[model samples]
Target: MGSLFLTACGNLNSSSTSSTTTTTQSSSSGYQTTGQSSDSEYQSVIQNGSYLTSKARGVGITQNSENMLNLKAFESGLTTLSKTEFSPKDYIFREGQLLSKSTVQKWLSRKSSSNPTGLNPKDNGETDADKRNPIYVQQIEEQDYMKEENGKLVLAGITIGIGMNRKDYYQKEEYGATYTTTISKAKMIAEGKKAAAEVLKRVRKLKGASDIPIMICMFEQAPNDSLVGGTFYAYNVSKSSTLGTWKSTNLQSSVLPTTSESTAINDNDESSFTSFKNKIQNFFPNLAGVTATTKYKNKSLQELHVKITTQFYSETEIRSFTQYVAQAAKTYLPSGIPIDITIKGSDGDIQAFIARESDSSSYYTHVFDD
Candidate 1:
């Protein structure tokens, strides 16, 4: 009797589809061409086309999609500046500064919610919903102050603002609404310092990895216009360091920034399957097609499973070698398969199993555990 085995073959490239627009770029330096559009509305220093069309004039623009959008903007902006006979370095500085301030204004406006009175009946009675009191809040919206630190160009500092409670309003039936103004300058300053410290730590690490610049943007707002508040931070990993190792704890939070990495896989599953079948055909020239079978059984606690055994041959020594047989079988095995060979008498047996549980659009192959 020969060893029994099960195997499965799948097509890998069946899921791949063609795209209409494609841009080729050198993958080594990270300056890959990411396509361009001729539409004037989408035309800008950014090659993506969407950013130029979406961005409003005179408004501060922060890099949105990590290095992809930012690198595109930086490179394109440099090209635009050079063509116009302007200094690229000066433009970066000037634009960055202006954008920082605009971002601060945007942060402040966001703190002003539609319902500031806290008159809504369903308001949960908590510190956050204390409309009677206003808390002093300060924050930096954006900063891009670049300076040389330890032989590396680093961006330090940040854009921030503070809001202090101007008054406390209370209900007085006869006199209508009246309140007293009370502001906490100490609290405002403390929060600002804390934000600065955190931002500084991030800046230091970013500067250390100058090869992979991290662009940082922060936004803060009053929680329900009450004395409570929160902050938001966004950062992008530069294209220059895309292949390097980077860690970002900020991305774990729901409100913070995130990043992505992409890769391509070989897509020629049909040909691969055909090659596999041809190899198997040569191994057992007279053997019929293989079939898959599955068996399942349940046992009770009292019953013990018994083993059955059978023997066919005593012992004999005989051998024959064929390079073609070995080559054909090896070529058909998947890249990750582990092969173990054994011989008895004059016959050879290959024992292995291939289990596939992938969908039509994807290919997944798993070898059975011995």
Candidate 2:
């Protein structure tokens, strides 16, 4: 929450900014100006800035401060925390570890969208309130896992920060590029993993770090579009050029707190998601969009969640709409796969309804989101 910017996009040995003030530009949508978070009223503390001043907070010092490590080309993206130790010895304290601001927002401007609100506001979900203020203070500690290196323990992993803002519709740039919202999901995933592979690009400049494994937390959010538009993502980034492991949490169950799933799916798989989305878009008219994923247990598919966003006029209309979606989706998916449908009106609360293979046993529920 403190520092949201990616490691200053280059060699870790790059020139350093002595001041606490760090400038970073977020991807702006339908804005009066470009996607510059550091410009306008938006400002953020660099993640490394907090790391550089960790000594002031009594956080552990990195093995080497002056030496910048270089990263080799590798596969990257987000994943759950797997090979990390939470002990204090594994943390790397750096300068500016005491940056004041925990989150940075550009609320002075509005991005036009088809949403009923007509304006898209980006929120960093670090706090529970909607307060819109910034301060220059933060106390942060960076931690990594340790591995044996030539008979010695060394810090060997890093968490690469990536965020996906939820909106009426998600827009992203092309691979290897920033600020272009005209790209496909496949391209976005590929590009994201590519970026993740370079987590060491800047931190390696720190003498003590080397061949660090990367973890990604892709926080994708949208404005009440569906259960997915208001949730968090957890992924396990791999260092061996393999796909990252992943998962997510949805808060929309607040609207229907009695819901639960039988099996969990990999929320990060793109191909499965795109296929289900295409099916809904083709079957339903006025489809705002969809977010679908499959969950696996012990390497076998067990559960499916299909979250849909569309237009509806009233309670009866929404119920009928959900009936058709849940039914069709239940029929469309293969046999025995427990499917749960999370339906959201263009700007309404998310209602969860479980659909089974029987076709006669579907009911909407107040699914509890944990």
Candidate 3:
């Protein structure tokens, strides 16, 4: 069986569970391994994490479809970045929960009633209504990868994360390495079984995927914060497990600062702006346009924010062009002021990254892809 390895930042250690696992067990390695149902693991071949569009965003749990949006982008010098797609469809979507964080936390603590079988395979009506839906959306981090077919986005592979309490899995001390927390093997099994059921339920709806392989994975998510990481146990038709990994959440939970101090404006960066524009054009000949704005004053440089809009035909172009322009902006524009870069694509697709001049580690990501 061919397996797809997703490059995530953390480590995952575990075994496999059949599509019908009902019980969970713990290995000597301190990882939770779920029981497998008597089913085949060669059911699907999950592809690498890729891009999608709005219409096909949650196909994993909704329509069992793959992603189809592919973009071609590059710098002026034709330099390309790593092969990754950064668009609206690349991330996961959680149902809007207006309830306070405290209330959501309480809901997650309740035991998961894992009656995996139901009429609506995507979501077991009883469990989804009683245990899963009210607590949180069950699909993992985001739809990982997919491609275009017949002018629509289909899901090639995805990571369906079962919501779990972080405090139950690992303990992070104030001044030491994180330690694995002891969680009941039964609960862990229930989580994986539910995820596998969701995959099987959705897969049944596909048109011609009976023989085509799809990779089904399970992950653990934090209750209300952005902390998401865990090993994905891969289950094949033979009921065997292959270890997989997920990206560690680099996002901080505390609210990002929105307000900036308004100080004197320096309208004197004209020459600097010219240099900036020249450098950007030299690298990205296909650059659509660049917009520079100043707000919230610092001592030397006005809070400098730049938005670079481009029209790229592929993901490679967008990735490299965005990075090239961002690096160029800092060199030409006045330093010591916080900088924000927003990249707008031809189809009005947008993504943004920010960095505080004083601290490099304080980088923040604000997704405006909507």
Model 3, 38-146: lDDT tens per residue?
2311111111222213232333222111111101000100110001221222321111112223322322233344533322123223322223322222233222333
Q: How many backbone overlaps does candidate 2 show?
A: 45
lDDT of 2 by residue, 114-160 (tens): 32221123333322122321111111123343332332233455554
Against the hidden reference, what TM-scores do the models get? 0.22, 0.28, 0.26
Model 1: per-residue lDDT, tens digit, 1-370? 0110111122222322111222232221111111223211111111222222211233223312211322232233223222222222221121133233443434323233553321112223333324433433222322232332332223332222122222323343556654443544454434433433344343344423333233332222322332112222222233342322322213110110111331112223223434644554334324323211111112111111111111213321011112332443355423332222222112323222222221122222222222
Candidate 3's C-alpha runs over 4 A off are 1-267, 296-300, 352-354, 361-370
Candidate rank order under TM-score? 2, 3, 1
Top TM-score model: 2
Q: Over all chains combined, what TM-score does candidate 2 have?
A: 0.28
